[model samples]
Target chain A: MHTAGDVRVEDRDDPEIIEPTDAVIRLTATCVCGSDLWPYRGIEPADHTLMGHEYVGVVEEVGSEVRTVKAGDFVVGSFVISDNTCEICRSGYQSGCVHRAFVAGTIGTQAEKARIPYADGTLVATPGQPDEDLIPSLLAASDVLGTGWYGAVAAEAGPGKTVAVVGDGAVGLMAVLAAKQLGAERIIAMSRHPERQKLARYYGATDIIEERGDAGVAKIKELTGGLGAHSVVEAVGTRESTMQAIGATRPGGHMGFVGVNYDVHIPGFELFLAGIHMEGGPAPVRRFLPELIQLIWDRKIDPGKVFDLELPLEQAAEAYKAMDERRAIKALLRP
Target chain B: MHTAGDVRVEDRDDPEIIEPTDAVIRLTATCVCGSDLWPYRGIEPADHTLMGHEYVGVVEEVGSEVRTVKAGDFVVGSFVISDNTCEICRSGYQSGCVHRAFVAGTIGTQAEKARIPYADGTLVATPGQPDEDLIPSLLAASDVLGTGWYGAVAAEAGPGKTVAVVGDGAVGLMAVLAAKQLGAERIIAMSRHPERQKLARYYGATDIIEERGDAGVAKIKELTGGLGAHSVVEAVGTRESTMQAIGATRPGGHMGFVGVNYDVHIPGFELFLAGIHMEGGPAPVRRFLPELIQLIWDRKIDPGKVFDLELPLEQAAEAYKAMDERRAIKALLRP
Candidate 1:
């Protein structure tokens, strides 16, 4: 990753065990994340920063202190690297651990090899190596799937609840999947694009609203008998998306937003009078990794359908472009 | 209430039961609220709007559908009138009931006689008509104390939590009391006023932060060993207060705010990145009125100390002016 709109497939020195708890991994699969496009679009500063925080990899080497996994073990990881034992981590917020680190901004994962710090806490050893067919789904669990899962959890989605999702990005579609898995009685997906709307239904969206802004909010209200959804997932960080999500939630409802906010501004007058609960940030995906991995391994859930394009690691730029242009919902790169 | 910066206590037609669920109450005591100052400060349009919502009163007359209280019943009421039987009311958010109404901007309680809509849901029958001394405390429950209680509850204050209260006004001070009552292990009050600071400590504040803005946040972080408080109550609605509350709370922590927001803009980037749980708005005071009234009747809590000045109802204008000028923490009016 270089300046805005510039990405290159260049060779670099291979990663090796750097920290006492670090584990070097040989990449098996990685995918472009919706958040990565922020820097790629110049919405954020990239300027040659290490990019990509999602990966499914095979452990190639382990530091002396690494005990959770050994070489040859395939692992699923979260975007945030945490020690997993801090008070914050213990309380299920590994994303805000005392010693947390962002792998995307520090050590890029879209490479042949990457180093995972706090390996035991950040990476989950899969039940042996996964089947090739299941690897993509497992990779999805590393970030997008985990983030979507956290969004549902934060929104308190569960049985008998009506969950509404804003945005049609990969995370939003996966949130539909998560809300379904969480037993939401009904899930509403707000999207206009035909393919994304279809995926939303496949992921268990009971209804899809094609309108945007206030019209979309009115649609949600119309569906919920004018009371609004009980739980709303905001997967878009724009001002309109945030407001729409808040507006679509019932007065005493909960909203969980996981979008990487860029220029969004939420007026306190609206937020205060909205009379809803909200919790969001970089999701503590690590906190939900074990359960998500087990579900994937047991064939209880399939979340990797998001990968609409597949390419070799050498074709990473094209993969990024495909996702950027919305030609593909998501692109999976195999090394 | 007249226009901004003006209030009157002129004679008006006596309120009679106007709705099936209405009850005419002869207020025993009424008080001005921090929020009343919003319109008083010209931030809100208050022309010809009924003013006060906090009161303790005797039921002078009850409509046929008013079954909860009788003509002689003494009641403690919430600021927001709700129908109690609505799905939202049944869900413990009477303030958000489909038929909810604000006592202010519709019908004022500062008058000698006022009509309360949705009597069963809006008013809690006190164990019995109380002594004069308990009137002020009971009046506090109508809004300030209840709002504070809801703030504490929304912030999830509980055992082992370090709770912080922002602002030193009546609501903020009551939040200290609420946090203490909710079993928060540590309560920090952020205030610069010496008298309010003393009251805060007396009300169970374990720490007092006299600094404002970032310095206050630094003090809180320093006090919490750099992890920030587990719960924060924002009683000031300005941008600084909101940010301070957000900053004082640890990631994964909860914050409840009840300030009447004025010109406050929250950048979504900061809110999303804060990684904290937040619930605010017009507090569901009706939900907690019964318990609070019981506590007040039992003499277990003394929220009435907030009333630093007491005067006759004829001095309503003076009372409003005193509170607006910060000459009094709160003012009690006798009809």
Candidate 2:
């Protein structure tokens, strides 16, 4: 990212194995994220910042300590790089691991090649080289898919639960898929976008409510026997969406929020009065990589469908614009 | 409370059965609560408002529809009145029951006689009339002990977990006891008060840190190998205390806040980044009454020690003053 709304595909030296635990991978696919819009729209500062954290690639070189994957191995890595052996990682919060680093600004997965630190701990190699058709799905596993799954799991979505997902972006759609796979009996997708709503249903949303904010909360209550959903997923980090998600969850229910929070301030008294369980943050994608990869490999989930637009790496600017203008749920960039 | 700082025991007609589900109880014991200070301190509006919500008493009369407990039965009731049969109640969130009412503002338990609605669902009868020595303990079960237990449970304190209690008040002390009973491996009590710190140790706190806010959080992290406690209980409702509790919890850990939040506001970005589970509200004390009453009856837990001051009902003003001035952890009033 050169400046606000200025994305350039610039030439740079290929990433190399700089650390004993690092591995360099030739990119197969990478994509723009909703959070990227923060810098693209100038909400967050950008000065030639390396963008894109989601990636699926083939190992090109590995440091002596990178034992998990070898050259020619295809892998999916977490958006947040983590030493999976850390206490936090062992406790299933690799995103907050003692040795953690973000893959976005540092690695710029959208390039031809990138170095992944703590490669053994951050990358999970597929059982074998995946078919071409599975590339996008594998790329989605790098971030959005894993994040949505974490949201659903955090919300405790399961059989007999009524899951309500707030936000109709790629992550929200992925959460709908996760809720379905988690066996939630009912899934309600909150969205005003027709395309996203249609995709939500395909991903197993049993109901759709276009209303938002206070009205959104009321509609959820109206649908859930006046008790609200048993599990709510907040995929938009804005204050209104966060509150709506909380209000839509029944007292004693759970809410999992995964959107990158910007400036949302929650009134403690209101949250206390809501009497709900809440958990959120950057998703521990590394924790779910193995399962997510296997699911995609088996064609049990087609998360790749979330990528409605695809472009070559040279057209990265157009991809960012498409996502920012809501013209695409997500955009895949082939190097 | 009659205006801020003015509490008087005034003469009034004894409460009668106003609802078919009503039961009149002759109070055995009642006590002042921290929340009462809100109105007493003029932070919240007050105008001759009836106070007190914790009580242990003998059933004096039962209306036509009242079941469960008849006249002459000794019982303990939750601070929140709930129709335990409601879906919310059935889901273990009795405080959010469809027909729930706050016992504080409506029917003041700190009286000679009081009418309780939803007798069958709100009050739990003891196995038998308790010995005179058990009165205070039974009264504690009405709110403090129950609320603390809920906090511990909500924080998921259990065998393998290191629990931290933020706040040196009665509820915080009770949470120490709860955490112990729940088998937490370690318990850290954050307090600057010597008396409360000693009480916390007695309640099974393994360590005491005479620090608060950021320093307290740092001490907790230092004690837990720089990972923070696995479970945290927030018994103080202030913004500083809430943030301290959240900060003291490890990534993927749990925090249960039972403090009656006043004007606290939590930054969403911070909470999200913390990657912890949070659950709180007016505790669903009714859900744990059976187990708590049994624990008290079996002499397994003596929660009555939280009350350091005792006075007659006519001395309610002095009791309130003692609590407001921090002269007493809690004050028990004999009606």
Candidate 3:
């Protein structure tokens, strides 16, 4: 598939394993991310880029250095993977590794093949070749699901914490799911869409606040004893959404923002006086892929339910459009 | 005393106790602050403000609730006297208390007689009435000095740490002093001014870099083997200074900003990716006042040397002009 304004179903040359450390996989299932909507919205840098990142695939070839996998292994990998031994990777921030490489557009996961770099460190083999029924959920583990999990962890969401998730997009909704899985006692999901509200509730949101801005802050304060939530996940990157996340957190709280930030500016005075700890970038999805993949393999959670629409890999453009136009919570593309 | 474009010495009626919770203090000495120069620069609100907030004075009277000090005790008090038992105050953020009040304009320490409110919680008595010689050092502990100490503490500067200070103003210099006193192994003072460079070296700056922006970032990386410092103190609030402080810190480092941020903006993406813990606002100078006072009394450190000029209260305008024009690091006004 070639990426146009949306990804196209056009034929392209088949990918081949080019390096000793590389792996070629036949994508079993792949999905577009809310971040991909950025390019569709004309905010992100896009130039002949393949559109999707999340994928679960069957390995068709393996490099000699990749001793961990064989041709038929089913696997899920993080978007960016490293040796897991470099200084940055060792520090648990694999996203910033000296040799970091992205998996989606460069390798084109929303196609019949993907060339995964640093296979030993990035790809996690499932317990066995999964059934077709598990494909969507396993694909979720590849990016959206794992990204959200990292977002929750970055926000410090854990037992007894009250987490407020800003944005009703798939990542934000999945963050609600992740926070719930992390044992947060109260999850306040901010969303206006009725369908998303339903999904948010299903994902364990204890409350829903439709308001935004100052009014939203007031409502959150009212619900949270005027102290705001202990943790907030900002899955939308905009001045307004960033402020809402900051305003919804109490003093000494933490905000984990996974949104691809574009021109978002936080006022210095408010941030200084608010006293909240902030940490998040592009999710180190590689760090959490193994555990999340395990969770999905064991059937302990059903994250695949987030994919409301599925299209053949040939219709990748429609997949992007479905998610961008809000006609679908998430779109799964089958190759 | 009158405060104009410049500080002026003038006559006024002796301030009467405004409330039963107030005390009258006969100031021994008062000094200028970088913050005070803000209004004179036409950046801050000007209203013939009473001018000074830093002082070492003899208590001439006490409120009925003031059990900590008696009428003849020499004391140091916070810029804002807050009742320590309030919910917000007890949280160790007394400066943001519901009833917080500042002393500079309403009860000017730059005057002969200064009115102190919430005296019991605000004033800390010295070992005894200090000698005339130790007055300036003690007065410095009242604001700028104490603020620097708090900044260091907020930055978590301590043993085996490398601390980077992002401003070369009085507070920044004093922060170097505070960080050194707290046992930081390396202190990188970001300065190029000869006067500040001398003071920074004297106060234990292990290194100095004059570059700003990306060049400055490169210098810091070069200094730290590309890992950046463990702690950073931001004493200047502009976007550039804030970014410098944040950017100079390592992944898990802390950034303590005590600068009065006026209309400054920070990019969310950079901050999130940095993963630096940040804390600071109006310094809770009160929290550090007692310990800083004791350190001053013990003569362990003399932060007061930052005052580079002295003038009688009558030439307050000249003092303000001296500081505003950068002729002095700080000025002292003896009323």
Question: TM-score for model 1?
Answer: 0.98
Clashes of 2: 0
lDDT of each: 0.90, 0.93, 0.82
| Residue B313 local lDDT, model 1 | 88
- Model 3 spans > 4 angstroms off: A1-4, A17-20, A66-73, A127-138, A181-183, A294-301, B1-4, B10-24, B62-73, B86-88, B101-108, B120-123, B131-134, B272-275
Identify the superior model by lDDT, candidate 1 or candidate 2. 2
TM-score between candidate 3 and the true structure: 0.89
Q: What is the lDDT of residue A108 in candidate 2?
A: 83
Distance from true location, Cα of B46 in model 1, Å: 2.8
Q: Mind giving the per-residue lDDT tens digits that candidate 3 earns over A223-264?
A: 987778878998888888889988887765788888777778
How high is the DockQ of candidate 3? 0.45
**DockQ: which candidate is best?**
2
DockQ of each: 0.83, 0.84, 0.45
How do the residues A149-256 of candidate 2 rate in per-residue lDDT, one tens digit apiece? Answer: 999999999999999999999999999999999999999999999999999999999999999999999999999999999999999888899999999999999999
Better by TM-score, candidate 3 or 2: 2
TM-score between candidate 2 chain A and the true chain A: 0.99
lDDT (Cα, 0-100) at A236 in candidate 3: 83
lDDT score of residue B40 within candidate 1: 92
Candidate 1 docking class: high
lDDT over C-alpha atoms for residue B265 of model 2: 86
